[model samples]
Every structure is written in C-alpha cells, then in structure tokens.
Target: MSRHHDVVVIGGGQAGLAAGYHLRRLGLDFVILDARTTPGGAWQHTWGSLRLFSPAAYSSLPGRLMPPQEGQTYPDGAHVIEYLTEYEQRYGLPIVRPVAVDAVRRDGDRLRVESGSGEWRARAVISATGTWWRPFMPAVPGRAEFEGTQLHTVEYRRPADLAGQRVIVVGGGNSGAQIAADLAHETDLTWVTQRPPRFLADDIDGRALFDHATARRRALDEGRTDTGGVASLGDIVAVPPVREARDAGLLKAQPMFARMTATGVEWADGTTAEADTIVWCTGFRPALSHLAPLGLRGPRGHIPTAGTRALGEPRLHLLGYGDWTGPASATLIGVGRPARDAARAIAELLAEA
Candidate 1:
C-alpha cells in the first residue's frame, strides 16, 4: 500500500521528533516513520548507567524542556527516554512505528520511501536515523581469533554482569572513559586507547560544549578562522562519575594493543594482558543504508549537505548525524537549530513546487 504527504520523516528518534515540532508549526502535511516499536529513539538503547552531558534544562528539544530528575545532577538514559516519550505526546507528532524503511528511491517528482509496512511518497524526506545502530569496531588483526567475548557499546547495559572478570575497555572517547569508570571497581579493568584520552575541565558541561560549537559555527559562517571548538577543549567531559573515576585513578589508559590473541591481546612492546571480555566503545557511522538507493552518499558513506539539506538532492534532509550535518547536531539541544532550518528550507521548496 502507499500513502502520500508533503514530507515523510524516517526515524522517529530525537532528530525526527525535532523536525516534527517545526513541521507542525508550519502546518505541513507530514508523517514520521519510526522503526522502533516505542518512542525515545536511540536513547532506548543506551547503557543503563549512561548519563547526559548536561542538566535537564540544558538538554531539550525545540518546544519543551526536559524535566529535571530530583537530586540528580546529570540525568541517566532512562530519564532521557522519559523526556523523549513525553515530548512526543505533548506535541502530538504524527508517528507510525515499527515500520522499517528499506529504501528511498526517486519517484518522478517525489521521493518514494519503501518500507515493510507500506510505502510513502513525499515531496521531501527527512532522514534522522541516528548513529547508535551502526557501532564501529576497528580492524585489528586477529580480532576474530580472540577466544574471549567481545561486545560494543550497543550491547552493553551494565557492568554488574561482568563483575569479578578481567576486562579491557577500548576507545578514547567519552563512552570509553565512562564505561571504563562504570566497570572500574566491578572488574579487573584495563582501559586502552589509540592515544591518550583528553578530559575537559570538571566545570565544563554540555551547555559549554554546545556554546563552543555554536561559536565555532558562527565564526566559520562569518568567514573567520575556524576555532577548533569542542576539540580544542577536550574529547571526554569530566562528568561526575568520570571525574570521580579520574580522581580515583581508575581511568588510566593503556596504548592500543598490537593485535588480538587467543588468550587476550598483545602490544607492540611485547606487553600482553589476559581478559575474559573486551568492550569496544569506538563509536558509530550514520545509519543511512535506507538512503543507499538514492545514490547521493559520498565516499565516506555520508550524504553531503548544506546545513541539513542534501547538496545533490535538496529534496532530502539529513539531520543529527554529527558536525557535518550541523554543529553538535547529534545532541538534544543542538538538533533543534538544524531541524528548524531543514523544515524551513523544505517549506520554501515545497511552496515553490
């Protein structure tokens, strides 16, 4: 079966919900297609111990603020899910769930979004399918040969399950640091990184990071020299837990392993460590496989865009991927601007058409 609208948004997560808020204000005919059976998008999949980088007020969508959790400085993943769920209900966004879109192809003057449940043709399409679904595991020799268990961030829930076991946590980003900290006292933990991990000042939070990104974006837009933005500050924000772990000397990181071994991993310096499990917090690529039929992706498997609108195909908008789509666009607070901009651009184009 097929339905039609002025716009069809794929992925009903934070990005899609943000887009829906703006689209509703513009009185556009649109429907959001979410693959998950429930709301909260990728937040539903985050580890139990994961916490947002900012306070509730600082992390919010276009229309509503996330309510603060009592006695909690930084809200956990469940709180984010609750906020996202309430946000969707408050706005009454039109959403159809559990419909996994397989391909988005050109259909004459419109775009055809083909999914298992049905098909939707729209003048414009918004792809907000975020990166959590595509966790990245780097290519290290003999990774498959390791006899112990291996898992990525997506599969990790809590550290209690792996308690009393020797485990290695790999990656230099916030996830690596946080996960390592979560497991510090529970496991015989060995934190490994490609390089030394950079921790932001204890005082800095998501609000500061968002400000830095916005400033950097404004500078570049005004043709000023690019300030490194968040990168200049650091990679890992010393969140309360991460800060505690660092202060307790639980986050000391080792250099990357030379290769995987049957027992564990071996380093170039002939150092070796045995482990029962390895948790990879490496990161993820954008979840854009549904857009493959459009043939608009660059060599990096990313759709090049001017703001959130696709460069080659202006009818399509890619939101909440990362800095390439918009500065800090992946964050709850950061996604609003790009979503608004994309919605406005689409409105203008559809009006012209």
Candidate 2:
C-alpha cells in the first residue's frame, strides 16, 4: 500500500523537526523524512569538537529552552546533538529516518516522493534539507596529484587526527578558522583565503556573531546592494570564532591558491607553501538535484523563494534557503520564521484542497 500524508517534511534537521513540532500542534497529519540514520543533520556530520559560538539562549528550539550552561560561550556539537535528540523524543514527532529521498515530483493534485524504501504521497512538501547538504570545493589544477590526505571540513573531527602534520586550510570562513585554530596547537597550520577576512570582535556586546547576524539582518536588507552574486551580507562576514583565531595568531590571512602540487599549494601571487594535509572550508551548495520539475530555482541553481511568498506554487514550499533579506539568511536562527511560514502555508493549502 502507498503511504499517504497531509504533509511530508524532508530533512530531519533542526528546521524540519521544528516545523514538525508546529505542524503537529496545529492538529495536522505530517511525516518527516530524513536522510541520516538519526536526527541532527549537519550536527551529526560536524567535527566532534565543534561548539556553537552563540550562547545557549539563542540555540534553543521554538518552544523549549536549551539546557542552562554557565559559560557565555556556545555549546559543542555533542551538546547540540543531545538537545536535538531530546527535542525529537519530547515532541514525539513522527520521523522516518535513514530514508534518503531521491526525488520529489508533482502528480495532479498530490506530490510523490521517491526514496530507496518506496514512494510516498503527500498533499504538500516542505524542503527543510538546509543549505549545507552539499559541500563546496573549488576546482584547482593538479588537485588530484596531491598525494597527501585531503578532506573537506565536513569530514574533519578532532585535532589529534592532524597532530604533527603540516595542515593547510582553504577559505577564510568560520569553519576554516575554527579548524585551523583547533589544529594549530598540535600541528603546523597555514590558512589560505581568497581575501583577508573582515574581522569582528571576539564577543560583541556579550553576543556571538550568529546572534548579531540575526539582529542585523534587517539592517542588511535595507542597505543591501546587488553584487551580482547569490551571497548576502551574512554569507561574507566572519563569525566570532574566526575573529578570536585571528586575534590569537592561530590563523594568518593569505590569498587563494592558484594551483596544487604534491609538495604544496601555489598562491595567486606567485608563492608556494608546503602542507601535509589540506582541509577545504570553502562553503556549501544546496543539494537540489533530487528536486525535479520545479522551475523555482534561480540562475545560480538555488531555490528562489522570497520572504515567505510561496513562489506562486500552491502546494510547493522551500525552507532553510538563504539570502531572503540580509546576511544571516542561511543560519538556523534565520530559518525559524521561514519554517513557521512554510508550515502555515502547507496547512492552508491542504485546508483549501
């Protein structure tokens, strides 16, 4: 028998789970389909030692409070996973785990979701897969020739793995800085960025950059200028941890690499540096290849939905998409509003049908 649901929320991360909680509270019948064997999408794949820069207050779900912590700094990945697991158990949200959805298509008035398990029918679909589904790695010449161990920041775990090795981290984003700083104590580290980062204070007014980005998003929307790129203000700025790394001399600002060799990386400015391992922290792309028949994507191949507008599709919705207003468009905090809007929209669509 084909399973049917009023709504199918894809990607059982913070966004999907939050939406599920809201939808259930509204007395709606829905099912969350997740790719991982368990919940906590990105957090599950994140480095084990990774910690949130934002304080516990900002990291809480919509209704529940994050467990109180003494330190003003953010909690680590394990703490985050624990909270997410508890949230799932607390809400008793129905989530289909390890069912990697391969594609979604519309059939008449219903939507069909195909995965390894089978097909599922839903009145509407909420794509809460989040933006970190695809890791972004630049294509550099001779990258394959580098005989040393190379891994993306997504696969990185602990510093002990890189101990005593000369590591080169690419990109000047928060992850790059954090990974480089974390490994510097036990390894020789060099950070390669396309450009010098715009450093912010370690702890701005006792708030982290993630929090500041959420608060400043409105200002960014008002002052935003088109740079002919998909990235917004939040996408380009450094978080608090990156700033701390710079202040502590754990990371040095450098230019992007022109090419890679077995020995080291060659920079655009005609300089070379040796590294035993390379960690690419460039960024990530949306994993939307599984979504077909949806002409809602933009020129850059990202889902194009503006400020909860629903993009003219009655039963289709996008969640956790970045660049809606200002810089923090892709953060977990930014997704809260959109998730609520999407849940409401899905409910209204079903009610009308």
Candidate 3:
C-alpha cells in the first residue's frame, strides 16, 4: 500500500526544508523525503573549512534567520549544518530519512514516487534534489590512464587529506578557487582553468550576487532585456580566504591542459607538469535521474520549467537546481522565494483539481 500525500518533497536539504516550511504554514498534507541518515543535507558532506560567501545574517531560509556564529563573520560548513538541523526541529517539518527515491512516474491523476523504504502517491511532487550527487568531471583525454589520484569536489573533505602532495585543482568555479586556496599552503598546488579565472571584486559577496539576481528577475518579469545575473559579476567570489591567497601570490591559475599523461598533464604546446593528485572542482548537474521516468527532460537533460512548475508535466515541480527553477534558488537565502512559490502553486493546483 502506497502512502498518499497532498504534496511530496523529494529532498531534505535547504530546498526541501524551505518547501516544507511553506507547505506546513499553508496547512497542506505533505512529507519531505531525505536520503541521508541524519539532517544537514549536503552541508554535512562539504569540507570542514568551507565558508559561506555571505554572513549568516544574509544567508537564511524563510521564517527562521540563521543565528550569527560567534567570532565568525562568514559561517563554515559545520555552522550551516547546525543551523539546518535546528531549523528542521524548530518547524517540526515532517520528513523521513534514509529513503532513497528511485524514480517518479505518472499515475492516474497523480505521481508515484518509488523509494527504498516504500512508495508514495502525491498530487504534486517537488524535486528539490540539488546537484551534489551528480558531480561533473570533464573527460580530459588519457584521464583513465593517469596513475595519479583524481577526486571531484564531492569527495573532498579537508586540506590535510592531500597534505604534502603535488596537487592540481581543476575548473575555475568557486569550488576550484576555494579548494585550491585551502590546499595552497599545505601542498605544492597548481590551479588550472579552461580560461583564466575571473574573481569578483573583494567587496562583492553573496548579498550583492542575490541583489543582482533580483534585478535580473524583475527585468525578465517586466519583459525587458535580461541582465545576466550573477554571471555578469564574475565566476568566483573573493571570500576572505580566497582573497588573502590571491593577495599573497598563492592563488595563480594556469590554462587547462590539452590532455592527461600517464603521470601528469600536457599543455597544447606540449609543456608537461607532474602531480600526485588532481582535484576536479568541475561542478555538477541536477540530480534528476529519479525523474527520468517522467520523460520531461530536454536535450540538455533539464526539465523545462515555467517558474518552478515543469512545463511538460504540471504535476511536477523542480526546486533549488539553479536560477532556471528560480533566481538564486541554489543559495540558502535565495531558495525561500521559489519554495514559497512552488507551495502556493501546488495549493492552487490542488484547489482547481
């Protein structure tokens, strides 16, 4: 027998929690399904020293503001986890853990969510499963033949793990920059990017990036030309550690190598450099494999969304993947708006039904 709910949230991360908060307030019969054994979502898996781009004041979900961390302007991963654990408790959101959802497919006027624990039928399904599980690693030629260790951002934990090794951090995103900086003093580190790294001004932080997203959203809603949002700002934010590393000449990047060698990498010009490990900070794609059965994905593997609702299948809503679902929706502070919108839309959707 499948449990039934008015709505089902497919993640327990910041995005799922945000959706649950609104759904509870609206008095909806909903449940949040999380795969982890405990709370904290993806934060529990991040590196020990990973810091937020904004202060706790600026990084919060709806209803509860993340309390300021003592002696820390930008909170670390542990702090965020603490806040998330508390946030779920504070709201008493209904969530089931250790339930890995295998697939979501269409049913008779509802959606069937198949999971390890059991199954669920819901009038609406909100997939807030973010990109953490789907780490993207570019297939540099000869990568399989390389003898050195290679790990993506998801597998990284701390600098001490790679201490004393000759490490090359690949990709130019925030993760690449932050990880490279974190490893610089501890190892012989080289940073490589397909193009040169673009760092945001020292003064700019997540708050500024959110504001940019807001403006771009407003412009698009008004049918005006879109202002490229955070991309217009730069690729990487110069948070305290990264900025300090750049100032100290420890954070310089080289162009991406043409291919990997048996022991290292070679540039297009045939220059070769050796390394003990290659850390791929190459980012992630949406963890939507569970939704593949729905067959709503486009050529890019993204579900076409109108606001947060899937265009092809209105019963499905996607949250927290990125700006495509909602502007800044991937960030802690930015996810609230979309979560609220999705819940309200579901309410209206159910009402009409």
Candidate 4:
C-alpha cells in the first residue's frame, strides 16, 4: 500500500528502535521499515561464538536495559537477539518486515520510499540503516589467483566451517580478534593487521569505553576538547576467549601482507604463508543505497547533518553511523541520544508545517 506517514524510521535495529521510542513519546505517526524477517539486525549474521565485549548493563538501547541472563556475565548474539525482539514487542512499535527499501526520492515536499511491496511517503525519514551490509575488502594484487576459500566477516557463521583448514584472519578489530581466537581452536590460524591493535588493560571493558565516549561527547557539546588517553572501544577488551588466546600466543597478528599468492598470501618480508581459507574481518560501509535516488549523499555515502538532522536535505536524518552521524553512534548505548534528539527535531519541524 502506498501511504504517507509523519515519520518513517528505517532499519528497525537498535538505532531505529530508539527513534521509535521517542516518536511514540511525541505521539507521532511513524512506521519502522526493517529488512530483516526477525529482529536483531546484523547481530543475527555475526559468528555464532560472538559475545558482547560489555556486560548487559552497558549494552542497552534507549528505553530498556538488557536484563542479564542468569549467571551470564557477557551476553552472546542470541541473547541480544532475544532482547531486541522483546524490545520491539514491548513497545508495540509498528515494523514492516522484510520490506527492503530500494530507493528514496522526493515527491513535492515529501520523500517517497520505494520498496518491493509498495512505497511510503514521509515528511521526515530517519535512516538508521547501519554499516553492516556493505563489506569492504582492500584491493590486494593476485586475489583472483588465490585458489582458496575467502569470505568477508559478514559471511562467517561459525568455526566448524573451516575446521582442520589453515585460515588467515584479516583485520585487527574486535571481530577479527574474536573470530581468530575461535578459529584457532578449530584450524591452523594466523592473524594479520595493518598495524598492531591496541588492547585496553585487563580490568577495563565496555563500561569504561561507554563512559569515555560519554565524557568525550560532553566535552564537545560544551565547546571544549577531550584530550587523549581516553580508551576507545576500538581497543580490544580482554574478553575471556581473547584473553586465553593472548595467553596462548594465538592473538598476535603480523603486518598486512603485500599480496595474495596462488595458494595463500605473501608478506612484505618475502615470507609466504599458505592457507586453505582467508577470512576478511574488514568493516562495512553505511547501508544507504536506498537513498541513492535522492542524490544528496556526499563523501563515503553519508550526508552532512546537525545533530542527526540532514543539513541540505532538511527532511532527512541519518543515525547510528560510526562517529560521523553521532558520537560513538554505531554502538547500542550511543544511538539513544541521537535518536531521541532526531525524533524531537522531526516532531518540531513537522508541527511547524
């Protein structure tokens, strides 16, 4: 059905849900368009062994805190999925499932969102489609010649898939480190990074990162500067398995190789390492293809925004894109402020018109 809404929140993940909460508070007529048949956003696609670096207390959305499971200090993907599903249901948020948005264009003063089923017109569109779909792979020479299995972090499901195989895990982020640790048990594994990864002290975790993020944002909002030495979540937190792997020396990663060889990869030092599989844990780009028809995006497919409100395109707002959209915006805890402020701004703008 082609219809109109006061606001349309896209993606229905943590960011979208947070926006929906604020929209509900303001009594706005909004619909959340989600691509997934189930809840949990990209968490469903992560490796089975993945765990949140933070405890449940530090990993919640806007309205509800994720209740820690009995005796479960850190929640797994399944637990997060369960909480997201419950959050959607608990708020009675209106979500259209599996309706992939193809394009967003302007019609008069409103924006039309085209999807497989139909189209939706909204006065304000909040693009919460995070950076999980567009996996990035660096251009390495001879990648095509490598006669081995290669998969991005998005396609990885579990460790058993590469059992007994020689696997090279690429990227130094949390995902790469965790996946490398898991695969080390099931295969002959090596880790590769562009530069050495920074790990926080063993006593720190997601809580400290969240606090640092808040402090930095507060400093910026007050027109001051946050000095360095604040720990970013980019630094690896010593999770249990990662700690074990570090102790076992499996967490060490060599510098990025120069090129891919016929069987595997070759380092700059002229040493060659052969592997049956290569898992690229490289990160993703923002999933903003649906807005291509609007022709408003600039660098890296993101539009300029003032506190989540799209600057040039006044009717649009983008949220939960790593630091650009909002401070630490990609995380579960960081999305709330932007979502709430965006929703309020949309309400005020719509009320004026």
lDDT on C-alpha atoms for all candidate structures: 0.94, 0.73, 0.94, 0.87
Question: How well is each residue in 78-123 modelled by candidate 2, as lDDT tens digits?
Answer: 7888888998889999998888888888777888888998888999
Once fitted onto the true fold, the runs of candidate 4 whose alpha carbons sit more than 4 angstroms away are: 229-234
Using all chains and alpha carbons, the TM-scores for the candidates as numbered come to: 0.99, 0.88, 0.98, 0.97
lDDT of 1 by residue, 283-313 (tens): 9999999999888989688888888989899
* Residue 206's lDDT in candidate 1: 95
How would you order the candidates by TM-score, starting with the best?
A: 1, 3, 4, 2
Residue pairs whose backbone atoms clash in candidate 2: 234-327
| lDDT score, candidate 3, position 2 | 99
The 10-residue segment with the lowest total lDDT in model 3? 226-235
Candidates 1 and 4: which is better by TM-score? Answer: 1
Report how far residue 28 has shifted in candidate 1, in Å.
Answer: 0.3
The C-alpha local distance difference test score for the whole of candidate 2 amounts to 0.73
Tens digits of per-residue lDDT, candidate 4, 1-353, equal 78899998889888889889999999999999999999989888888988887899789988799999776688899999999999999999999998898988999989999999789999999999998889998889999999999999999998888999999999988888889889988899989998898777877887788788778778877989764434434567878888899898878888999999889999878999999999999888888888888777887677777878878888999999877888768888878888888988898999899
Instruction: Provide the global lDDT of candidate 3 against the true structure.
Output: 0.94
What pairs collide in candidate 1? none
